[model samples]
Target: MVVTDVSRPDAGSPGTMPVRRKRSRIPGWLRGVIWAVIAIAVISTASYSTGAAALTSSNTASTALRLALPILLCALGGLWAERAGVVNIGLEGMMILGTWGAAWGSYNGGVWAGLVAALAFGALGGLLHAVATVTFNVNHIVSGVAINLLGLGVTKYLANLIFAPVSGNPRQSPVVPKFDTYSASFLSDWLGGLEKEQRVGISDVAGILRGLVTEVAPLTMIAIILIPLSYYILWRTRFGLRLRSCGENPVAAESLGVNVYLHKYVAVVISGAFAGMGGASLVLLRGGADYLENQTNGRGYIGLAAMIFGNWRPGGLLGGAALFGYADGLQLAGGGEAVLALLYGAVILVGVIVVVQLFRRQWIAAGLGVVGAGVLYAIYWSNDTLPSDLIPYTAHFVTLIVLAVASQRLRPPQADGQPYRRGED
Candidate 1:
């Protein structure tokens, strides 16, 4: 019948080459969802087994959100500056300035005024950074360190002058107004009932959702909205393109008339403003808006870690902040028992990694994963609770581990931390 076989390209046609079908890769959002699901399952199982209800409780989730807010803001600040080719090592300093400004503003005016003052103070810190690194071409790291010192000294002195009289403490300020929180009308109640059921994964998810919808502060809502807003501005807008180009290649951007210097300046200034807002979050929420000495307590550096873990993206940083905040919140909620439950969770997570590594024929990695899982399980079995002193460092430990794991996948701005000057090719 001489029927032509159309299925095989190379079968009938002369000099035809067979085409290979490309493998479909999972979308980033889908991958994130899968990982989140896996994490939830692991934590939920651990929570049930250990009877550590705090692991999945609404209180813990709420605490995590509260703790994560400042870090998220600071990370966002770092993202803005780095994306525009400026390395903002002075985020801590900007945040410090923000705390003072927030306390002062809140005491004199109100919570809203405090927020505005925080942004202004942070912008001031950013301006100093820009003047040093952008105008004078100072070393980014050096300038950042100097700015940190300056922020600390200036704030301390100001606190003594302004706050000490009323509070009777140089490192403290008078009580300021705090933002009120809101809960979704019916959703919070519905979710709370579902969470009370304690039905494994479903209950765990409900608790998390309940926490999100219940008693959420206005500032928290603002911080959450910034994530998507940042994505749209940086990825979709022309100004964002120019800013990112400056970070990637300032000379190239300048060649294209992108005004690299101006973009860098604006980016750094914005970065400071964000950090300042982070500081404001801490002050306004902590103990009814009272400013305490060293309230930031290295959150600035932690936020920078979150930024790195996120690989310099808004969504990624949010996850990183959430992770650190969760660790911190768990310790605060359930004390040592909660931290112990986390060990069990780690064991399960490591076991999953081992299985994945085995499937990929990664013999060494799988072997290491097995050992890690075994050690973690052993620790979990032996200890009923983690040491009290160690609880405070749980977030830091999480930060180091997460950074180590994610470091290989990170790709920072090409010209990050590099000094740039006009007319210099």
Candidate 2:
């Protein structure tokens, strides 16, 4: 009998067996199809007259970053909860609580105090989720729902109680101060002739680039720093491993000497803290907090979508958040025209699709995303007139369908929604 050479590759010999190439998981034809679709869409869209304007409007970097920041933070929070065996359906409620806390804190103690209070309150809310789900063994989904309801009701009641209708300034909350702009002297020195201009002189492209890049917001810098730190803490550290293990198989993790309960509690608390900070960022950076019901405005859901789009990765979450932010900026800049609204909707839908698909196949997904964006541009340019109100509704409906279908096929981690249990895999 002849011995097979299967083990020959691992034998201690130099240059004895051929090196096996890693097989490509994605098919070539599929990639080709995706690329083709993207190419066609881009060419068609670019040929249209309004394509330039739409692209320019969509690519405004500052506006996109600002809009994306809160969603990014929220998604990161969700990532933590899910990674640690907790399903946080109550992110919306948490956001409301945070907003209310920040407002109350700012009202009493000022902006700094409001921020600290929001983080603390957010952690408290997380504790609520952990106690109800982890300790009591209640259904995670139900617990989340309950927390959301409690948050909404409590926040509203508190708003009324504190800033009642009797007060003329019922809707108002203390505003946080904005960051200072670059000093005139610094700007003038950096960009020659800027001293003569009101803000920064726009003599050339270099000046414009300097102006755009130089004016860094505090939150923006914070966000950039947090992304890598979050990634490191979640994947590279021992604590992160324990948290993941707990989520994936709580029983096994418990048997391995991991404190499952503590991990779950910590995860939930962190989730809430980030969410609270996000709420504060929205109010402080965007505007002062107000007592409007549902003030978070579906941002929680948006954050959830972002988490899925990001595949629960910190860096990916930031990218997803930025895309959504760009969508928002487009809506703001386009002046609510029917065509513009439709175009914006199309862009968002396409972006979501590309991100989700990219998880399965990077090149194919990239091609498709490019194509989808191009198609949206063409649609905007081809139309001479668009109905404003109907466009947003229509776009929203289309996006909803696309997202629903995409989500159905995208599987989250196996331990995504389970509570960490003590001992036994």
Question: Residue 207 of model 2: what lDDT?
Answer: 35
- Evaluate all candidate structures by whole-model CA lDDT and list the values in order: 0.86, 0.65
**Which candidate leads in TM-score?**
1
Per-residue CA lDDT of model 2 for 103-221, tens digit only, reads 77766776677777778877778889989988988898898888888988888777777756444454444344433333245653565344124231132322323333554566556
Q: Which stretches of candidate 1 lie over 4 Å from their true place?
A: 1-14, 18-22, 286-289, 354-371, 406-408
User: What's the TM-score of every candidate structure?
Assistant: 0.93, 0.74
Over 4 Å off in model 2, which ranges?
A: 1-19, 23-54, 57-60, 165-216, 286-291, 337-382, 390-411
Clashes of 1: 0
